[model samples]
Target: MIPRLVATDLDGTLLRSDGTVSPRTRDVLTALETRGVPVVFVTGRPMRWVDELHDDVGGHGLAICSNGAIVYEVADRAVRRALPLDRAIVLEVAARLRAALPGTAFALERTHGFAREDSYRSRHVEPVGTPHGTLEEILDDTVVKVLALHDEMDGDAYWRAVDRLVGDLVDVTWSSTWALVEMSAHGVTKASTLALLCAELGITSAEVVAFGDMTNDIAMLQWAGTSYAMADAHPAAQAAATHRAPGHDADGVAVVLTELFDLP
Candidate 1:
């Protein structure tokens, strides 16, 4: 059955590991749009990253950004809506996390730009001297995600430690293996955002298809009517999804799309 909507993750799902979108994948997505099937990019990525990429994949639509904390209009780079973690919640979580996990550094992903503690080394290229201060000092009117990383923890240990500290307080998940934990409003996730958007569009979960790879993408993978986990997807994602596609580098999404829609 043809879906009314299709959703996909970016970093390690839709885009190759090197962050390139294959031409075949691009064309297949275009074909879906032409057939009146709306495709949504549901990712943990910030709106800023959408501002940078997504143009290559017909980004003139709405995107679920910041792990459902933000709805962004790709065309104008405007925020349609934002479900933010309350400032109080942000502060409280940061405090608890800091005390429980020594050497845990912090950063903020605002609706507009980025902010981080002086101790938090940035992994993304941001404008010079991006706001630097305590998490309390750097906070703005709207904070979509609170990014936390440990100086030592990198993979599973990092995930386990952070998850233990605040998993009960807010929604916590990770897209990368950098000991980074992305926290949003409690219970907010890609699935939450997708469901909200589908409601607005008058579509049903049974009418949607989704694709993802990481833990951050798991909720979305489960929520969609038909979902695919990438060949290299985490074990949890594989369990959540209905099927598996080839890895992103192989244009796995494109291959599945081609067979689904029979696009030339």
Candidate 2:
């Protein structure tokens, strides 16, 4: 069936391995929008990281960001809505996680940008974020998501461990393969926010087609009526999706869109 809406994750899914969108994918999305089928980018990236992607969705499209803590409008270059973790909950979760996992670094994804603990060293310099500061100083205000970075553990192991500790307390997820964990307020996820948006648009999950390539996209893949897991997708994501597409480097999502919509 032709989907009324198209939802896709960014990293490792719609983007090439180098983290750039291919011209073909961009054009296909723009064409879909022209045809009255809205394309939504659902990702774990924060608002700061998404500012440059305004032209990706024909310069004006909605994005579900920060694993569902934010809804950004590309053209307007504004956050239409922000769902931040309660400061009290953030404090409680941080304390419990620190005690459970020694040497873990903490960071906050604020509404405007990012901040982190002084000792925290990200795998790469974040495109946008303040220099390191004390955890308390970084989190002085409410934040959309909390980051838990570990030095010695692998991504899968550390995430599972965090799940064992605070899975019930907050929404835990990760998009990249690095030893990083992201937490949101409980019950928040790409799927939840997308569902709300779909409701507002008078669309149903069955009329939506979603795509992703990581563990963070599992809930969304399962929520859509038809889901595409990129070829290099995490095992859980592949298991959750209704179908599989080529790797992002191969323009897997574009291949599927072409088939589904008869795009050139």
Candidate 3:
């Protein structure tokens, strides 16, 4: 069946290796929009980051940011809903991580922005082109996610330590080299957030198709009607998907969408 909605992950799923959408992929997505099929970007990125692509990809539909912690409607430029982090839990987890991995860089993601300690500026090198902000100002608002960024640190080891220490209090996952760890409230995830959006759009889980490529995307990949893992996906992500596409650099999403919808 042709899905009524196509929900996709951004960084390593839909976006190419260069972090840009290919012309062919963009054309296909635009065609999907023309057909009135909602294309929702379900990503670990913050709402402000989503704005960077609003004029391009988001012109077609809403976005699910912070891995489902918040949903934003592009047309109205308003937050449709939000699942904020528990303030106490966030503080507790942050304290524990600081003690366990002293000198490790960390950031907090709020419904509208992201926060980082002043020390993070000099010690950590962000991914090329990604933005940064101050933690003090950001924490004054409702937080939706927390991230740990460190180089030369064993990501799996850190994740294990975090799980052992605060796993019961938050949801933890990673999208890239263990250099980063993303945390959300105990029950908030991309899957749950997408389900809510499906209801709002009067669609059903059976009519949704999703694509992803990392541990953070597992839940949503498994929840879709037809889930696809990128060819270069992590083992956990591949195992959770119903099928596999080529790879992000290969425009895998567009390849799968065209075949699934039988589009020319």
Candidate 4:
């Protein structure tokens, strides 16, 4: 069956290991567009990171950013919908996180961009090109996500710590070794975001094919009609997927697209 819409996570699902979409992937995506299959990117990254991809995939795609905090229309570069964090709750969570991990670096994600305290440099010194702003100033705005950096924190420990600390107050997930905790007003997730997108496109969750490689992608994977986990995906993700595909380096998404959609 031809999927009416295709929704995929970006970092470890659609892009190759080097963090760029391969030429083969690009060709498959273009062919899907030609076949009238709407391609949507569901990611934990902010929309600012979507421009580079928009250029590659053309400006007609949709993006679910900040782990579903915001859905953007690439054609007009506008936010179609947003689920913002409650200022009071977010400020409280930030305070608690700071108290728990004194030396930890952190960033507050807004619909437009992300901000970090000057002290962030002491811990997460890696330059990811995300602009920095004071925590106080960021709290004054609508925060969509929070990223915490711990040099020695593996994915498991990171998730455990955040879950124990925040619990149901926020949604915690990881890509690589970085811990990304997304706080919403109450309940918001990639699956919910995709549901909204599916409604807009007249598609159903049963018509969507999703992919991923991390704990963050779990909800969406389970919500899709058929979900695929990468060969190198985490155990939880692999268990959640309907099927397992090749590793990201082996063009997992491309392989599935070719077989399922019969792309050239």
Candidate 5:
């Protein structure tokens, strides 16, 4: 079917493992929009990381960042809307997880900045003098998502344990190969916010095509009428997707898009 909208995860689904967009992928996405199929990047990335993508994505497009917590206006570098995590909820979740999973370290993603405990090892470099504090010390109402980390556990294992402990209380999902899980307020996910936007645009779920390669992308993959898991997608993601696209390194999403739309 010809889709009205296209939703895709950035890191492991669209972008190559080297974390850059391939030239072919870039052309395909731009051509997709040129043909009137808009692309929305739904990622676990914070707005900070998505900044580099504005020009690459044809200058102006919307992105669902921090999973579903923030909907960003790409060219404008503005937050169109956000579903921030309540600080009280973050504190409570952190308290409970710390008790059950001894090594879990906590961090906060806010509208304007980030803060983390000394133990949370972030892969992306934070600015010097970024806040380093306890949850009680650093948490504020601006929090968009809560990050939990464990150096010893596998990515899936860590997510499972966190979900088992607190999934009933909040939304827990993992995208990183590392032992990191991002928690959103209950019922908030990439699909939830995407649904809101599509409704605003008068698009239906049956008109949306989505792609992803990890646990975090499962909900959207399932929510879309048509979905593809990247070739090396997580087992759960593969199971949720209706089809398997080529691997990210192979510019898989682009391959599928070109075929579907008959783009050059």
Candidate 6:
């Protein structure tokens, strides 16, 4: 059966290793959109980090960002929906993680921008946001997600340890190659958000195809009827996917979509 929708991740799945979309991939997606099958960029990136990607989506795709905490409408350049983390829950989670993993720093993803603790070290050379006071002082606004950065371990190791400590309390996931973990409200994930969007579009999970390369994409991949993990996807993501495609450098998603849709 032909898929009615295509959902994909950004960092290690859709974008090339150097962080740019290839023309072939862009053209194929445009053709897919023209055929009435829309593409959705489901990612761990905050909205502020995804602004430049508007055109690649052809001004028609919806972006499921912040691990499903936000749904951004590409064409309108507006937020269709925002699922914020509860202030009390966030504070509790932060305190718990801090106690368990001493020296760990925290950051917050606000509706419009990002804010981090004074001691948090951002992996990005370009800082994600300004230093707000301690996590306690940053609760005046709604928090969509929380970023946990640990300087003593790798991303995979940190995620595993964090999950073991706080997995039952909140949703913990990591997408990048840094020693950082992202937390969302329990039950909030890319798959959950995408499922809602699918329903709104009159499409079912069985009619959707998804792609990803990180642990964050595991749920989304498992939820889709047909799921692809990029060749270099994280172990968990690869195992969750029904199939595997070339890595992002090879335009894995485009290759799969072309075969699925028989596009030129």
Query: Which structure among the candidates has the greatest lDDT?
Result: 5
Pairs in steric clash, model 5: none
Better of 3 and 6 by TM-score: 6
Quote model 5's TM-score.
0.97
Q: Give the distance in Å from residue 239's predicted Cα in candidate 1 to where it truly belongs.
A: 1.3
Regions of model 3 farther than 4 Å from truth = 121-138
Q: Candidate 1: where are CA atoms >4 Å away?
A: 58-60
| Per-residue C-alpha lDDT of model 4 across residues 1-264, encoded as one tens digit per residue | 677888888887888867898988888888888788899998887777776677675543888888888988876788998888777777676777778865556677677566777656433333466666667665645678776666556657766786678766777666655544445545678888899879877898889999989887899999999999999898999999999989888889999989998665
lDDT of each model, Cα atoms only? 0.86, 0.88, 0.82, 0.78, 0.90, 0.88
After superposition, which runs of candidate 4 have C-alpha atoms over 4 Å from their true positions? 122-134, 179-185
Instruction: Estimate, for each residue in 58-92, the C-alpha lDDT of model 1 and write its tens digit.
Output: 45357899999998888777788898778888888
- For 136-180, candidate 6 gives per-residue lDDT tens digits of 877645788999999888888899998898888778998878889
**Please, what are the lDDT tens digits per residue for candidate 2 over residues 22-49?**
9898888877877888888999988767
- Runs of candidate 6 exceeding 4 Å displacement: 125-131
Ranked candidates (lDDT, high to low): 5, 6, 2, 1, 3, 4
- Model 3: per-residue lDDT, tens digit, 103-176? 66767776645557655643334445444555444464488888877666787777767778778899887775
Candidate 1, overall lDDT? 0.86
Worst 10 residues of 2 by lDDT: 51-60
- Pick by lDDT: 1 or 6, better one: 6
Listed in order, each prediction's TM-score against the native is: 0.96, 0.96, 0.89, 0.90, 0.97, 0.96
Task: Kindly give the number of clashing pairs for every candidate.
Answer: 0, 0, 0, 0, 0, 0
Task: Please report how far candidate 2 places residue 170 from its true position, in Å.
Answer: 0.5
